[model samples]
Target: MHHTTPPNTQLPFAQACENNQAPILAVLQTALQSSRHVLEIGSGTGQHSVYFAPRLPQLTWQTSDLTDNHPGIQAWHAAQTAPNLRAPLEFDLATSAWPTPADQPGFDAVFTSNTCHIVAWPLVQRMFELVGTHLPASGVFAIYGPFNYGGRFTSDSNQAFDAWLRQRDARSGLRDFEAVVALAKLHGMQLQRDEAMPANNRTLVFRKSLSQ
Candidate 1:
């Protein structure tokens, strides 16, 4: 049998999480200024959610991912003491029933980091679509990851990374920023900012435009 599964560590750690969290939080501070409720998709390892929730006391941070990731996420949630940080919700954007937030108007922000390239393209489309449905007017969506522009790689390193990802899983690789923005537009979201992040990554912020 082939070893297809990633190693299981109780407190599963990710160096990328530690390195990028501070920078990402800084951007979130400004992006989510008026926001209250935030739904974080692909809350892998529960690291980013736990790290960010306490700092942003004004917003309630919700963490969610596939069922297999729940135990590790719960471990992190248990360790954290912030009241605003919520327990992980077992969710799949493409397959889930499209659950709405408990509050009336819906979530004010949705955040996902380093997820698009790993999932299949159809699911990536679904993520953009479903985020549109969950967000209230003026809601913010912040996606952090490396992406190609004009269908060209930003750096040779990103090119290499993309190749490695595809070798690991044929469907996995960097997505074009233009294509992603087009998808966001179709769902009533408008690009508000595109800030460069460390390690050649970017944090793209979009705000919901439809009012109804």
Candidate 2:
């Protein structure tokens, strides 16, 4: 059977996305079995949502980021047709009110990639608090990015990357893994899995507990 491929859509591409998507997918396939609605924070190029939505048709993927990122997200969403993929929306973690309705029961899972180090420390705290407020009890929250452990950089390359990030913005450097776990704990989530990824990055999964 002859098949015609769709023209490639030129949405902004993150090089790391190309390298890490497959491994991330492998982890997600296992972690997301019980999730029906996933809200992806900082959907950057929207590649992850587009890639995963089709593979896991059982889950509805909601992509969001700062308002500026919506265009690229829309472009990628438009290029593909998936019933489970919703249109991108504005979701600033630091804000008090999200664009989505307040009465909503919140997502079954929340996912973010390569965003923590790029945002300020306070925003990271806010992100976790918002996840606690917006996710149901026992819902999962997953973060994928480079992180420090025990006050040390994981690799020489991550050290250099940290230096580069600090040069751009003094606050824009990797965060400590333990600190993140502590933050999650304060907000009623427990660290579930910490999977090491290619190029010194890690995916941390946290599950909201019933106590909170």
Candidate 3:
């Protein structure tokens, strides 16, 4: 999910992971406090997975991404000693079926960071569909990334970041917070909270309706 892919590196690294891990964890400690298992979409370099799993010892962290990113994820996983950390799963919301680990009934929570703005809009919707349908009732869904509020950028930096993302991939850009909330609602998720993150990013937390 981290955009900057280091070149010619034995173990891929994303500087943003180091910068935001603590803040993200602060939020997760409470948001996912009751979660038993978490499915991480777009694990990227797996830096976040490694850093977070050991800290959140209560839940099993499952890292996933497209197959090409597996090597980097494996590299990071290899260096970690967290028994709760699972290996990378080959996940592509656009193609691959939703993963259901044989060891568990299904994941109770879902977490993804810096991914919605990187993929096309349809894929983003597909991700929501999968999560909405597969996640158990009263599950958690937390996504971290830059988001526009009421069709307006939250800050000048986020505005510039949106422009850069579109320039890089016309199909990819900051998603509207309202639109995302609406989408989640359609999938039986209710907004729980929105936390401000560094660099104009936001972490949106939603809880699946108990009746879902």
Q: Lowest summed lDDT over 10 consecutive residues: which window, candidate 2?
A: 1-10
Candidate 1 off by > 4 Å? 1-9, 101-105
The local distance difference test score of each candidate is: 0.87, 0.86, 0.91
lDDT of 3 by residue, 49-149 (tens): 99999999999999999999998899888877699999988899789999988886589999999999999999999999999998888899999999998
Q: Write the per-residue lDDT of candidate 2 for residues 129-200, one digit (tens) a residue.
A: 888877788899999999999999989999999999999999789999999999999999999999999999
Task: For candidate 2, report its TM-score.
Answer: 0.92
Superior candidate under lDDT, 1 versus 3:
3
Clashing pairs in 2: none
lDDT of 3 at 118: 91
Q: Name the lDDT value of residue 158 in candidate 1.
A: 93
Q: For candidate 3, which ten residues in a row score worst on lDDT?
A: 1-10
**Residue 144 CA displacement from its true place in model 1, Å:** 0.6
* Clashing residue pairs for model 1: none
lDDT of 2 at 165: 90
| Candidate 3 wrongly placed segments (more than 4 Å) | 1-9
lDDT of 2 at 196: 92
